[model samples]
Target: MPIVDLGSIRGPEGPQGARGLPGLTAVPTDQGLADYIRAGKDSKTGQALDLAPLLDKPTILSNSRRVYTINNGPWGAALGAVRDGIRDARILVVSDSTGQGVGGSSMDSFPQRTSWPSFLAQLMDDLVVPTAHGLGIPKSNSSAQPYDTRWTLGAGWAAGATYVGFGGKQTNYVAAPGSGALVYNDPRVYANTYDIYYAVSNNATYGQLTAVATGGGTNTVQTGSQSVREIRKMTVVAGSASGNNVVQITNSGSAGNVTIVGIEPRLSSQKKVIVGNASVSGSTTSDWVAYHDNTVTNGWNAFSYMSAYQPDLVIIDLGINDAIPSAQASVETYTANIRQLITAAESAGASVVLKSMIPSVAARAAREAQYVAALDSLRYPFVDLFNRYGSYEKTSAEGWMADDVHGNDRIYQDEGRYMLQALIMSPMSLAAKSVTIPALPALPVEGWSERWRADQIPLTVGSDVRAFMSVARTALKPESTWTPPTLAIGDGGRKVVRFNGTTDGLSLAATRTQPHTVVVLGRLRAISTAANNGIVGAGQSAGSRSSLFVSTDGKLVINAGVSLTNPAAVPTTTQVFIGVFNGNNSVAGLTGADTAGAAGSEGATAMYVGRLGNTGMAQLDVEEIIIYPRGLSSAERTSLTAALAALAK
Candidate 1:
């Protein structure tokens, strides 16, 4: 008979198999099994891997723009690029004789009439289609001196610039009483169409110039024409004063507004116009004003004046005078003053570049040190001109300066290039990466125990125990010709000792046994000369030998043989004693009262259990004395002896 095949003989088809539950394969794909393993290993090993250490350095952020310090003279071809806006650079050229070493010479006649500003204007015209305007001198009828409007017109022609001109007197130009006249105002006269009218005359009152349109109907003024509109109705009162300049400007029309966009005075007068300078001197207190009225008075007062015109950037080059020993105090004052000024400029929305003072051999090394110190103390972004221009000794022959102290025009120009490079590399304009500190190693847990051992005491347990045998040999000894006591184990696994040396025929037993590990920790002494034949247990003295026998049941008598014959004759002090560790594991509990058998002793048989009760395991030793508190059971006794045997090893 053929065996039935289960599948072939199936009576009916089984229901469709239920879908199996998804397994670990369904877990998030982003984290694979390897990641889980790594995380687990990290947790078990207690390793905190800092991902931050793997990141790139931190960056410092800044919003400051670039500033270029140009020479006092021509800027050449580069000026065109800057002016043309091809290079969006803010150029600052120092004009005062102090900057040019002209010794109070006028900027126009400095031999380089095509000065840096002129070159800059030309550059602006070539590069930037809309050139910055120039400022013009204020015109007054009394003063016929040429206004030198060329600088103004050049600046304007280079780009739509404005000119800020200073006048000898306060005079207003009007278009012609009622009719708006043609005022041939050259765009070149001002850097832009807007010009600031500055009055330098103290005696002049507000004077006006008017022009009636000759052609009528708002006659247009010719470009670069020197036509003048009539002076407006006003008066002049002569006044003799040091700071008597009154500067104000009105729009071309009575109703038309005169928007004086910018005013940067070329002269260095602290009491009057606000401009950057090495120093300013004037009798009138009002000559100086804080840029944006920051109210910080110092060397910055001069710098702040230039900043007030809303300059995009400022170039601060100082420290020459600061190097003088006579000017040391002044240098410090100047440093603090400049710092405040920098803060003010920053507050007033201008980026400042402080140029470190150049090195000089004027006073030799002392001067250089002072200047260097001042620069080092400054926190603002700065260029090290001293280091860049080579040392005084190194560059002296290369046209460094003829005066030996002040730098020449060429040096200034070279320094300007250095300053430009520094601006590009300054921390203010760069990003600084973040820094990381490594974690420290873990400390050992047993450090406290090591600290204790250094103090000269030894504490130990088990295999780490310290031997006190040396202490006993030096501090205690039997009487003359007495052999040292043999240290050995006692009954019940307790520590004990046998003194076999001569002791004046007197026998003493000392045992150390506590529930915790027993330690023969301190020095022990044997006083064999004492006439006392007594023993102390728990502060009580034992009686005589006749009563010392144990019970038939083997219970050892505590005070059984305690007796004192001729008690008065026997010295009442000496007694057998034993030391035990206190409950807290400290040996401090052994006060004078516990010094066994002294005066006021509670008899030799009264054992002082250290107030810790019988929780302490004990050891008893005698000159072959036996102790059976309750007659140890045969098994218990055997176990005790075995423990003692093990301890002896």
Candidate 2:
């Protein structure tokens, strides 16, 4: 049988090779397999093997499930690497002088730059706190109140005429000759000795004044004669054992209406703020910027010292001082400044954490609430210190503040603990959550292969011509003078290329005579105010070819066979998107203008950017440019316009 069978006697394909290993229910392609592996574990079994035991610490899953191996080293080496990373962690503390002991003394244990950095250093290593002292920003000493006292009634009340409360009308407190005149009893005053501010309205009576507080004899904090409407601040005594201090104001010479507008304990000089040094606190430095009457002025971004420090997290504890009546900063202005700060900070590669302004004194309670409300609406990592200790009423009752503007040690400690948690813990990864990417409009299943990104192109510093990607691969050839890629401006730290109008331009190799779409993200230079500033063009001259330019009226114009108008103006400072689609029948353009066009023919030879051949030289800055072989659909055009608009912002 063996001799007879041989190679000539083969069976009929052996039942199709036994069905080829069950036909793989799902195909594992590059994308498919990656997604599957990311899902982890066998779906049917619903179980996962502990690969760490077989491999090592920080194990990574291989491409194939069947392949598994141990790491090159032991777990100790991996842990050492992690420790090094932890040691190199950079932490930045941005706060008022409270973090640097401006008005108050620093805590002895952590007496240095900022107490937060020192405390965090004690817990972990590699913490870097930047020195904010040299930022050249102003500082304030007088505490910032959260409310605007200007909203209260009797704003111009006489100096001697008393007001019942912050919202009260004019009232008179006339004292009998030689009899002590009693003012309102305030619980916030210090039991030992504290400062009291009285807003007197037109005090014309000249008299010998004697001030008294609970559980203390009369002490003359100030002497007033022939007083006008003025704010008189004096140190007075208080009642013993947390009792309300009955403040008495007596004028021996004559009886007159004396008014006490507001009274609260002033921020003490001994109040401890920041505490740490650069050496023991892991290169952290706290600058004392908290001064009297410091508003949210400019120069916040320009940190003089430690300019090289990149903050991992930026804490902004401002606006309380800015909300004061004297500061005169509106909530809108303060919020705008804060937004700018956040953008700048985030742009500098740091996460921002906005701290809510704490409760202010009773006089500015309403204003503080508005400021806090503004902060609450902003989109960022936020810490509600105002709510943490207790809200305005509770804070006032619990005595969590050294003064109306700054918090005591208890508040600072609690805040530091929360901050430490945010720093140490992993912020929930965006990857862990399901991502929903809006699907792009599918290309017409036809020709549209030409693609070019200006940012991706290669160019030399002094080269006359640079090559770019396109259906007709064009190169930028500057004729005489050109500004190279230096000016950069964009959100998210994206940079764009700039070109001078007179001489800077791109030269194309061959004529592109097919129906094509051109997309550009660009902005006009400040100096270029000409009516016909070319953005992207493809032809020997401006009028004879396909091109998009800013017309004399500042609106975008497309000259592709026929001229089409884009309703939006080209912004000089901000970037804009200009798209031109020369279709089979008609040529059109868009600037997020979404304009329609009538049917027309098209003619274009060589391509040019920043200038229309040699005539319409343009001083323009371009961020990105794309040229497709075929015209784009309405959906694709709209989507691209919107996407580019977001980038411009």
Candidate 3:
């Protein structure tokens, strides 16, 4: 019965079998992005829309995000402090040759222009606004403000350094004779103290050091503790406050026996960001965890004694060399050792970020992949850059690489920028906010300030956002040529529209309500040189305008002329800006600052965001904009401030 002409047993197509639920008709383009794959769920209606995006590349676990927002305790402080103009933010990057930005599988003698650490330091330096008291000392301009100042005295770990006996790129190999001194006239920034890393070649000769004054008034005995070949650090404090930035180190006559390997100078009581790089070529995690046991041939030990010194952040860039086939570490061992490094850093009051191994040569690709994927267990701020970057072959074809193991200047620069954006845009954990918003209940609150809510557009970057919807699901369209602002991802993975200071533009529809209050949640990317940086505006021109802006001297202005400068405010940081228009009684509020004066007109017939005609184009990033039919009461303003402040962070 079963075998009765089965080939001819195909009945009349069986009514198409109900069409089999649309056959998953999603094309490759529907997969969202090439690096990410999409999955859909059944909804009993027509086709189910895209539900979730599953990463299609290598990563430890989905939980190990590009940045660990929650666990980034110290990192968040460092990030926030730097953004807030904190004076003393330091980062220590311990890594192998890749950390040094040396392209090629093997360590090179010179450095490429774009190392992740250098990029990190530069990006951080950009945010630190210069004040009368503080100037950001970055590792960016090396010749102008060098970070790694080595001695040219000895071989071994001191190879990278130059002897300061004669100022300039240390070329002389001789030490100061007798009680004479070798002075390091630091050509960089002015500093009060200096970190001196040295190795003793022969008999000990590390002696007194005096640079506080030219007259040898105050000289202290040096640390002088030296191992056979281990790199040791000695902190030299200024004897007095008013000498030049010259460090005079004296050693008993042992010729070039006492060699200064590295010099990191600290500004006397001044604030700056110094990224100390302690990286050796072709070193691994094992080499780091072991105190003085770095591969002898790989040069200086890139290890820092955390107990004596500390940094705001510690970026551990290992696993690249560990993935070498001959020296391949077990994934478990790699995971455990990485944890060990994290513990040491965190225990020292510093936040840690893990750099996943980059793509390696074909021979070590598989092992490198294992080392990268093993980071899922670390649960720290992980830079899963290897996967986000193109494949080895694809990258090699791009001409951004010198060898399979190292990317050239261009690729390294792009990678560094990519890595930097990942790190800076890390999601801010809710538990870490200084102000906790009194939890709001389901919508339609007692005093609803927002006429529109939940205006979530396509989460994809570069996707056009045509219209935003109100609570009633109706739409508010922008001008014909205008739509979504220049979309970008800001800190905390928040989708925002960033204005490019000079050219970018976007506008919102004119206000519909007569007595309207417009609220904007955003921050300026920088302090504009313009007299005023427009945020939101209405009316025809500057004279007859209802607007909110940042004044030249860092004042937040509302529709009714500039307000009294708030004592407890920073115009550059994120703020909840409110503008109320009601003719003469119109008012504007910025966090705690408020001003009451006459607005050009009421009802806000015309409106714009991140732009004010042509002259006041804003260079800022905006997260959300809400409008209410009328002015917010004092209590409502308080509640809104708390709610918006919580989001601002």
Candidate 4:
């Protein structure tokens, strides 16, 4: 960093107490934003970047209207959280006919065919992780009985009921007082817990009244008058496979417009991985983006609620429909729309993963190129199934294609399983397992090579932490146990190693010279030590020396030869500490803020971590440490600090 002659810009020294930079409490560089979306490792942080939403990373994806955190949350630290048992993962499949599970079995309807999302659910083993949620949307299961009969409309029902049942649009049956009801078959074949979701504006009550001569259950519900179409779920029927009214809603005299959103059935036997397959088969990014603010009662002409499923990670599988248009204008529109959808999903605190779909016709695949490129440019987690599984023709060669556009059950199953598997084997996920500091961009102008990471330390109590990047580098022989703190973010399952402050310490192999940079990702266990607690310091066996340590008064004192004292610099929690020293020019930075000063000839001795010379041993939790043997420029230091911050997974 440059030592500027501020005499030119200086007005006058303010009063007697303030002349230098004021000490700042620890400041996080960014507002905790993740870096990658494609399945890979970020070159900057050397941490995993993913093609799925890693809720743990908590990155940002901002557009014109809002900014969003792509956290794979309500899920877990990684993708396919259900398989990992992080949470019973809620996956909302927002696709088209493929999402409807159409190509499987015979070319029949929604009931007989298993959805493509079901394949993914089966792969995630969601069937075994029972939760209170399940997916059987009314539109998907439109047919009632007699092999082909739709729900029979009763009296007082509007002609629009035809549009709702057959046409899966936001338009619902506007029933007048005591109107025709949606009656099911006698034998409720797939009987489970059925919930009728609706939104009534201007105070309306709807549900089954008394079981008249028609034979239906007697259950009524009163709704409030709300401005927005707030969704409501009423468990209309809970029947058995032994013949019952699947769900007969004899509207309980609703005076106002009772907009029926949709019906969802939760199968008791299949409550593991709650899969909401509301994918609009012939839709694109534009269609889904249009649903950003849309709810069930006023959504697309499909059986999907954009965010109501409460997914931890929204795997947006688009491109085929968007790519179908052969104009460049379509690609730009697609890019904007997809970002809006991502903004919507992220707005709900759900991480988003964009997956590319197959266009089928070889020529249409070319049009998809711009779409894929556009998604890539957006830098969201994008899974290129077309590229990953090879072309449709190739997949068909492997007998996984149902036709030109859709994949067979086998291939679809593979796609589902691989999505989670990709998350499992992603570089981001695996990096948390070991050698976490390898990819951090610490090697600037300094040829310094010594580096060590505490996160990779084996969980075994007494294991020693060694330096990677080079075997000959000094190892930290811990006198304390290996227990990483619960909140160490990016290290995944691994944790920080704690020092008990007694004999717990580590030393550099050789005494360092004048100019060097040191960065430590750690936290102080105890403050208010009488003697300086050396975090990583060098120079003789006593006195101040040149160090980055907690001073006798509990301040984070930084110096090259001349120590600067600031009480607030004391860090009690986790932080990234950076110190640069080169004779009369030294800079100390904690978190994002920094303070620079004149450096004396200190910091030119062997460095010791967790100890000040021989006296003040520190009680600390160490996550990572880096020593670059040269003075870093301001830009490199800033870049390095930002990269380190992204390490919080």
- Per-residue lDDT tens digits for candidate 3, residues 1-649, read 1111111111111122222211112222212222121223212223322212212223322333444542234444444444344445556676665666766322332352245565454433332211111111112212322233322222221222431211113312234435445555433235666665544332355433333333324444342333223334456676554336555565544333345534566664655666666554555676555543222221233222332235556778777777777777888877767766664454334556677656777777787787776774555566676675646786677675777677655555444544444444333222221111121224221444444322232223553333333332223333323323445777566666677666445443355444667778788878676556778766554422667777666666665332423333446767877777666666668875667666645344455666665557667787767777777666676777777777656
Q: Candidate 4: deviation at residue 286, Å?
A: 2.1
lDDT of 1 at 416: 33
**Model 1 ranges with Cα > 4 A deviation:** 1-108, 111-194, 197-307, 322-329, 364-369, 424-649
The candidate that achieves the highest TM-score relative to the unseen native structure:
4
Give one digit per residue, the lDDT tens place, for model 1 in 396-459: 7665554555444444434432332233222232321111111212222111110100011111
Clashing pairs in 3: 150-161, 150-162, 151-161, 151-162, 152-161, 152-162, 152-163, 427-492, 428-492, 514-603
lDDT of candidates 1 onward, in order: 0.27, 0.42, 0.49, 0.49
Between prediction 1 and prediction 2, which has the larger lDDT? Answer: 2
Count of backbone clashes, every candidate in sequence:
73, 26, 10, 20
Top-down lDDT ranking:
4, 3, 2, 1
lDDT of 1: 0.27
Candidate 2: tens digits of C-alpha lDDT, residues 1-649:
0111011111111122211211112222333322332343324334331111211111111111111111111111222223333211223455443443322224332222223333333222211121111111111112321212111222222323222221112212333346545454323122344434343333344334566666767765222442122334456655553434455566544544343433333222222111111111100111112110111121111121111232334566665546557654667766776665554343333345566655666665566677667776774545555554445566556554566655554444334434443433212121211112121233332354454443332221222222232312223433223332333444345455667676666544445554667777676764345547878776634433677777777777677666777676666765545454554344445454556674245657666777776667677777667666767677677777677666567
Q: Give the Å shift of residue 455 in candidate 3.
A: 40
> How large an RMSD does model 2 have?
27.5
Q: Per-residue CA lDDT of candidate 4, range 105-168, in tens?
A: 5344342134456555543432123333244444432221112132455676543433232124
Weakest 10 consecutive residues of candidate 1 by summed lDDT: 448-457
TM-score of each: 0.31, 0.32, 0.44, 0.46
The TM-score measured for candidate 1 stands at 0.31
